[model samples]
Target: MVPTYLERFGDSVKFELKVSLPQNTLPKNTVYELIPSFRYGSQVYAFDKKLGFSSDSIGPYVSPQTKASFSMPYRDGMEKGRLMAYGQLTHQKTGKSLKTGEEVLAEGIITTSELSQIGQYYIDESIPVMGLSVKYGDQDAYGMYKDGWTELQRLFMAYSNLGFAEKSEYMKVIEGRGDFSHKNLLFMELKDYDKVRKDVLPRFDRLAAVSMATTEKSEMEIALLSRQIRKGEISAALLNEAELAAAVDLEPGLGEKEVLLKRMCEVHPSAFSFNNLGVVYLNLANRSLDRTEKNRLLASASEAFDQSNGFFENPYAAYNIGLVYWMMGDKASAYNAFYRAMAITRLDELRKVHEAALGAVSIYNGDYRLAVIHLNKAEKNEINLFNQGLANLLAEDYYNALIQFEESAILDISNGYPFYGMALIAARNGEEIILYENLSKAVSRSAYLRKRAPLDMEFIRYHDKVGFKDAIR
Candidate 1:
């Protein structure tokens, strides 16, 4: 029979204290609460000492169907689904640790009282252990799980045989023989890593994608937060799996870009939101035709990027802000933005983008020499090569300019910019036939270039020519 005092305390005989979750959200790798014995002695409690269960609390939210997918905040990197839980067992009134039996730990992180400690009474816990003599079935879990149905059936049977007092992690806190409310604080790692990945994660990813795509705003957030927990850079496979259930794009359906981003920001305030919001705004700006609206979108993009900088000093965000300035035709601001990004960015790949942006801004600013220097530093690519040629042409370096344009042409046969560069060179040398041939090819490929050619100063001499009018038309 349980004592009246123990009944009133919900048999909190084991619980010295329990920490409430912050905003009802589970945190990873945090020491939630200390569990000191309320009674000072070498006695081991059943729930506390033997099994590690405490009083009633909400079990972590898990999927009702699969029981795998849950609201666990995907911890970054190696911390995903793993933690080193630490705790100490101290006396209730003596204020000293009880070093009894063998000090054990979930991962040896807890300062368990050992043989070395003075004035520490070892509390012996009587617990049964079970192990299979032959290690059961196939040692290679992957090969065994390939026969998944059979393997899981055998595994479940094995688990049932291994018992802990006919009671599961569920413990109710009532006065009589039972408690109405129950809770489970224990978590387990999947023993067969490859097996779980092959069988479980795909289903979870499918759910993640569906939740993210649906009109339901609340579920969409949890799905995105789950995305942030990948140990490595997210693979296309996982994203593809998630997209299978989506009928429409997640971004537009949510709401206006700013409103959607703000809601996301409130739910999950991470660099992921800040960076992606900048991108969405930048894309919106590009799509808008009205100049004032475009500028307004660019301003929003810049602000999103600026907010991202508050989370982390990222060159990706910096370059995006620079791009917004460039599109708005603010050459000085664009170059300064790129230069600032370039100075702080240690990654060569990101630095290349910053350098190329600075080069393009220099071309527009009429700083041909600076443009050449910046363009040369950029990674060799069709776009950068074409821009380099443009800068060289402005500086009257036709030989270097032609070489750059020809290389750009070879890299991307479909792009018309390189041919346009060659036409400019021919126009400078008074080669009308050669100039008109290249100009025709350039105009046929690019609508914008075709529209601009007739009014271009470089093509002024050819504007009156029949071939030029034909190409422009």
Candidate 2:
């Protein structure tokens, strides 16, 4: 009879060998010899000790019970190989040996190569594998050989057997000759076009036919692909493709300023975007160099600001509109915008606007004392120090402006504007030693300030002084 063998536990195997004796035969000292062997790949091993049995029974009685066990050593790269056990039983009494059918117990095949590749891939992607079983199958076979084989098969199916499902998912995000419009819409919303195009799209294209034929598609796989795409580390072509899938709707003959503002409002309706749209319009108006374009851009800017106010209560929006009105020489509207901004948020920034407004009103109404009072109050706020100094200079309060500029420079030494203002004050006061020091510092801080000094109101008088231009140069 053949040996009945079974794997009893992890790293150990159990087998029960049964041998038959001749009928009506008996020996005073009947001895049975048993040898066990196992083969794996090109390597084979025999148990070091021979299994021995002796019995006095006759007439087909079972021989003395004997059990044998052999340990299987852990081997790398042996997962794909098969293990077999073979043995023979011999009777010592008559020197007869019977080759009990070579019991060949086949072990499950292990895909070590595939498992190593997957492990390396996970490492490259910075994924942690702690606590998770490395082998295939459930927790019951966590460290068992069968579990490892099972895991290998599962991974193989994902990469090969279900290739078609993966390909369809990839094409859905890349807009490549497929109905990927809805996927593209989702991609655009998630800002994940680039990743889908670079990684998923290309990988699928390479294995397109295989993926299309796959039958084991899974929602988890699709979700994982989407997450990887949104990480934004992928290519820009993917983003462009997604954008193409979700094409923008545009109207004919729309002004550039109008179009930009409308798109900003529709695509990004945040307070920051609205305020930025207003600034864009204001910039275009300033650079138009044509009265018609300037009026058009300013009108567009005003409309954007109005739209911004509806979405967000921001002081900067009102303040920016006021600046546009002031540029258009509309004093009443400019003042109204400025006052509205100031009321919305009592930001010290509005004090500078109020100072400028009061200075203009005082000069027009011939109320210098009121203008000085407003400017003095504005000068007290750290936010308005720069503008306050400039206002004092305009009011011909040169000494006071110098003091204010000096204080402002001390507060923010990196501000080249204040440094240049200090240089101007020093030169105007004929403090040549201080002038040289301040100008040198200003030039060191900013090359632009040094180059523009010659064209400045305060520095123009001393532009030709010896070594002054050379120092700036």
Candidate 3:
């Protein structure tokens, strides 16, 4: 590793480092960020216990640099030391992340689960950590600072996803004892900021607070309201839409959602929040463990969705309304909701969500043909394939269902539903041997399927068969 050169300009100090790396270390024509994690105080300057990361920039000749300025230790009496800036660089490829210039052995690399197990070794809680190797051609990185309230990797993803205002809001909240804009952040390239963010932004783990309506409520206010909600002092009337949404997630259990969300939609009346409220009620109904309360909670959920569609022509709200109605056993009403959802023009971000939702509701409403249409609109994946199989099965297109289920099973061998569908499809066609094989595979993966098989209507024709009994046994 080459030494990082330091220079002082006014109150801030700037430094740069250049280093060698493997041939073709970074793909050409792509942008990458040089993220630096910093530590302050005299204790760390002499030596710090945390494992440090040091790297020399690879191809395209990285000239990573940064600047820092620190005030005197304390405002009142005295603290320990002035702030310090530091960085660690790493390279990730095909599920391996190694320190700078460390060769990730081409074979028998660590699995994702193993890396997480390795992460368990981090007991310091104070030191930040890092992650995954994107598939080839997606080697991109962006800069983010980690500190209290935002050290989690998900926060970085949220920063990438947010608009300028939202990103600034997050930086303002988490930049404890520091400022970000003045920092001379270095990236390997200056391209794909928007594209990279778009590709990675809508990942499954979105930061709830960052994603919510923060323009109205600051992070501190939401934090305070969340504390009150957790402590059983949920004053729904006092919290705004964002706080109420956060409360929906923070509330210990199902009890507060009924009150909190109802009040939330009453005051704020956003289509999105109401759509979430519908989901919350659906969850409460699902978790009640009492069949008698299911219809009532579902009805309340449907009402919440009714209010949502009143606010905006939202496909998600309409789709959710359809889902609750179907659960309520009102098939015609569910169909109407699905109809409205499919008719509306959805936003780019919601197009796939809307397609997935409509496809699911179509199956519930017994519109198998419609289900197939909507499922086709969605991007093909294990879930959609399984849903398509369901649609085909119910529509009595046994051959098509068999093909979809077989494909879905290959995608997720451990998911019992696809195998279960295959078994039922084989039963419909009187392919006795195939039926027994898939039935055994399904029950082996999930014990619940073993119980459901005996009572399942689709398998009724072959229930008494000796093979069926033996497979479940």
Top lDDT hit = 3
lDDT of each: 0.48, 0.46, 0.51
Give the lowest summed-lDDT range of ten residues in model 2.
Answer: 112-121
TM-score winner: 3
Arranged by lDDT, best first: 3, 1, 2
What's each prediction's TM-score? 0.47, 0.36, 0.49
lDDT of 3: 0.51
Error of 1 at 453 (Å): 1.3
Candidate 1 structure, TM-score to reference: 0.47
Report lDDT (Cα) of residue 454, candidate 1. 71
lDDT of 1 at 30: 27
lDDT of 1: 0.48
Model 3 CA deviation exceeding 4 Å by range: 1-224, 229-240, 250-252, 256-259, 266-269, 360-367, 394-399, 456-462
Clashes of 2: 5
Clashes of each: 4, 5, 0
> Every model's Cα RMSD, please?
34.0, 39.5, 30.2
Put down candidate 2 lDDT per residue, 1-473, tens digits, no spaces. Answer: 34332222212333444434454433445555556555556776565755554554443554344455445543433333344444444556567766555555544322111101101111122232111111111122111111112232233244432355554454343322111222334444543446545544445434422321121324454333333333434432322211211211121112432443344345435343455566667766655679998998888778767665554444556667776775575545665765566554333444455554544433322233454665565535322354456546545577777787778687868655555566666776787667767787767776556655554435545668875766576
Clashing pairs in 1: 99-122, 100-122, 100-123, 174-179
